[model samples]
Target: MEEHEKDLEDVPDMNKKNSIIESGEAMDQLITIDGEERITSHNEFEPVPLTNNLNADELDPETTAKLRGDAIGDTLYSQSFVLKTLLKFADLNWNQQFEEDLCFLWDMTAEKSVCEYLWELSFPSVACGAVAKYTENRFIEIVIGTLANVLCVGCDKTMTKEEIGVIIQELDSDDHLVLIQVMRFISSVAFSSSETPFIDEEAMNRLCFVLNNSINTELLLKTLETTAKLTVDFKLDKNLVNSSLYNAVLTAYCTLLGSAYLELDTKDGILACRYMLENVTNICGYIDRFENATLKLDITENLDGFLQEAIKIIKYLSQEENLLPVTDDTIFFMSAFQYIFINLNVNYSPEIFIAISKILYIVSEIRNEVERLFESTLELECFLISRSTKQRIFKDLKLLSKHKRKTVLDVVLENGPKFHFAFDLKDLKDEVT
Candidate 1:
């Protein structure tokens, strides 16, 4: 009985030893295969494992794709994708969300690679499409505003002649909202660079069409403002004024001036007047440059026609009704006169000189603002004296007196050519006699 008890105890000891060996082997397998150490229930611990793999399903698709694309070092989000998404959202009238995403992508376009991608996708086409598709002003503004921001930041490499042509074609859309945005977009593009490829006669003609149609007061003014910017390029301006569109542009200006003068007391009317005057000043600057070019070519015929247009504009603006209520408070008209005086150098054309003199005479008679007119005239006389070296200003003064009963000539004769030295009143006295 004792021997049997000893065998049983020996059996328990052997079994315990085998169990411990198995447990150690299991722990070794865990460490070598799973890279995780196993812990014992008996107050023993093991080190935590390091992981090499992540469950990608935990991340969103965009993040996953971004990670994958970043691993490969290429852009994960494409301009086309962004543009398509925007187009889809715009079509659905999801404007707020569209703008949010659009601004994000627009910011991305600052990257050269992204800008190149946008060029590849033809961003202008997308912009025009958005403008044409969405009747919502804010949506159109977002799309166009994005484009303008891009251009303003010098992402003009995305600009192409084909894209510009597409924008120009959209200018005829009867939708004023679309038209206004298109003008704003074009203005932004043109102002982006002096070497912009978008300044063409067709573009100018389209702009003139907008001006002539009288789409809206704001639209007309905006179009006029863009036209003024475009005319800053002398070649473009000369081509524009000499094109078939010139008549349309001039008619629009005439209509604007007439309307402005008739509605002078109103705010819109005053803005319209100021815009037209600014446009005229731009045209005058173009004329000055054109004259310089023509002088080199020894040509003067086109200049005469341009001067006649200037006279017509000045005459309309200086009409008795337009100037009769001219008080110290007539800010826009005074500003218009100042702009014309600053921009229109009469030494370029005899007709312009005569027109300026006549306009000054009218202004002096109406407001008795002779001192202001005299200062302007003396400035012109000084420019003429320096350039022509002839005291012909007194002759102009005499002619101006003959046309108007009360003239600025009295003011000029009193000032006596402050900027000229060889001015003898004898010549003036002879011309008067």
Candidate 2:
């Protein structure tokens, strides 16, 4: 067992990607991306003090150095004992000791040196087995979390193709918590670590199912993050070419905004408010909440970015669209264009008004240079109409009222479509410009 928790810098950025904890209080977000102090991601819990609790006897100092543990693992023998104990309890599922060991492993794996040593020791094999064998919600969540921390510490070129197949096979699930962690795992580990991510058809289908149908906001957010990870991190567009996936991204704004019917799973059904920033905020603020801020934040950036990347991939791969300008009528882009134009007339509520802005921003992104589809000038502006909140998350969104670049607000106003305002968006002015 290590005597120290890592400084935040020592912590793996894997868990920090495209997600924010649900910090239950509602505080005003004030931002000026250029001038504002850096907005720390947590309005929620502080980062965990990452350290393992195991204090077992060392296997041997000689053996530890042979396994590249000399610097980080002067105490590698203690880790060996922890690993052996973890295997012993793998099939035991959710026993208290097994859970404790799993948490320790997850904490230990957060350090890259420890993670690499454990990988060489076949901890990843142990983890994948547990991921398949564990049925209880708690164990499945922790083990998947551990596996993600292990595999995704850096670009994961070390993992074999077979290991990814096992995880991809296990992704079909009815539990939101299990699904959420697994989605995070895939996005963080499989996509970043692999030269070419190996997703089986079943896993891809399950992901599409989650994306197209699920109402669970946390799960949906994670699923969207997975799409972003594939497109952004791996640069793998073939994985995202599913028609269902494209349609899901297109109609996602409608589903999340409550502008369309969503299928519910009885196991963890959600009300319409689950996807709304305001509703989720109100509900999650109740006691300790585990809501995903992804829908409000991550999806804000990923959704459009994913689509734009997919389009670029399609053009580059097919070598056909470069000859013809990609347009609203182009076969590949029709899904996104259709979703945007069709939903243009739908009225949106203020707290969730960001949904419309998101979709409209998507349209503006695709139609223009497609330069920064995921630029997210509007992400910080989400769920806010306050003059102060506007300046805090400062991006080009502040100039929307003045119709800068003919921003989203400009399009909505000029179209004369029904829109709900939390406040006068025109007042969300950037004084500097």
Candidate 3:
């Protein structure tokens, strides 16, 4: 990245077709759909001259994938100017004007054609090169954000598997913004490819690197998301990840629960916790898919410590004050501790939700309750008559997730709208980070 100065500096100015932006007159044809103007906001910046251009060798492994289609008609911009600015971003001297230009690049690259054209111009090396250089946070965020937009391709965007590997493996995990963008890049790589382990083995290790090291909530969640995407519902490929990933994910959950600096009682903390828990559950299932006794044993050993940490999180979340309301479930939380009417089998426990999506998703009313029911969850594990005497409420929602959530409309169709139901996961762990 930092070492690619010569490759970047030596770009000897592209041809006039790409070089000249028509500030004087826009492209003659206007883009239209059904004869109506297709309006879009364009970030305008005064065009600047680029000193150099890429050699033929620098544009090797050119990508022809087109996620964007549609001419840049009447847009008043040039592909060459966009490409040159991005390549030279790291080399430019600091100024408000340049920052404004970078912001414009950020907005311009969102168009698929721009992303496609940039990829053709060997964008991977240019983008990854900047990531390698130690730079300011805002620069890292903009460039990486732009690169992530480019990488979010409908077709193969891998310029070179090795170069892609370099981009992921070399990111700065300590920088929260950098880690977040890299996570998006990782996610794009996972989804864009058709293969299991979506990224190359070497690049996959970078996920563990970020998971094991990053404390940023968003980055952790994003990295976990990418990792979850790469996992198969059945068995996992031995090469997808090594033993260290489990250790890293489990430790991340522990760190998250124990983080004194974060306001864990906040809604965002609760959401982060819920996502991480789900991812951890998925990882465990993935590990269980391993037929190799030794590997299974190793992962099971790792889970012991994580289970302890998880218990602590559960305990922390179990308190009455820690839980928030979906406008307060069943018009009462355990009917304000008076009575909880719930169904259970002989083995009903926290682990039961994993087998069936024991999700108790309900709203206090008619429509939203049914909407959340079909949209997010399964059976009602809690349904009962209410008695408003208590000095309290059970708030222990973990028990409600034992059965598939029923549609409130369906239930109301049978039992009427007055029917009361309460739902919550016994430590919700379904969707991944």
Q: Per-model C-alpha lDDT, please?
A: 0.48, 0.43, 0.44
RMSD of each: 28.5, 16.8, 15.3
Instruction: Point out the higher-scoring one by lDDT: 1 or 2.
Output: 1
| Candidate 3 per-residue C-alpha lDDT over 1-433 given as tens digits, one digit per residue, 9 for 90 to 100 | 0000000001111111211111111111112224432222122212222222323234334321121122232233466567557656557565666666776665555455556677887777787677567466556656666766666544344656665665565453445555556666655555445454435555556667667766655556566655655553422365564557768776665555566524556544554454454445445455445544564556655555654554454344334344333332322222211111121111222432221222222332333644543222222222221221111112222334333223322332343334343422121222110
Off by over 4 Å in 2: 1-77, 89-93, 155-157, 193-197, 233-240, 259-433
- lDDT by residue (tens digit), candidate 2, 172-244: 6665555666775676553434344476555667777776676555556556656545543223434334435
TM-score of each: 0.48, 0.46, 0.52
lDDT of 1 by residue, 1-433 (tens): 0000000000001111221001111101111215433321111122222232455558798878766653311344454556566557445646455656665564444333554555556666777666655555445544664565345334436556766666666665665544655665666665544654566666666777666666345556567656655555543536555434444454555555454333545555554555555555555556566664533222233334444545554555455565555543233444444444544434444445555555556655543554554345445533444444335554554555564512444545555454454555445555554
* lDDT over C-alpha atoms for residue 378 of model 3: 22
Minimum summed lDDT over a 10-residue window in model 1 is located at 1-10
What candidate 1 gets wrong by more than 4 Å, as runs, is: 1-142, 149-158, 235-238, 243-245, 260-262, 265-267, 284-375, 380-433
lDDT of model number 1:
0.48
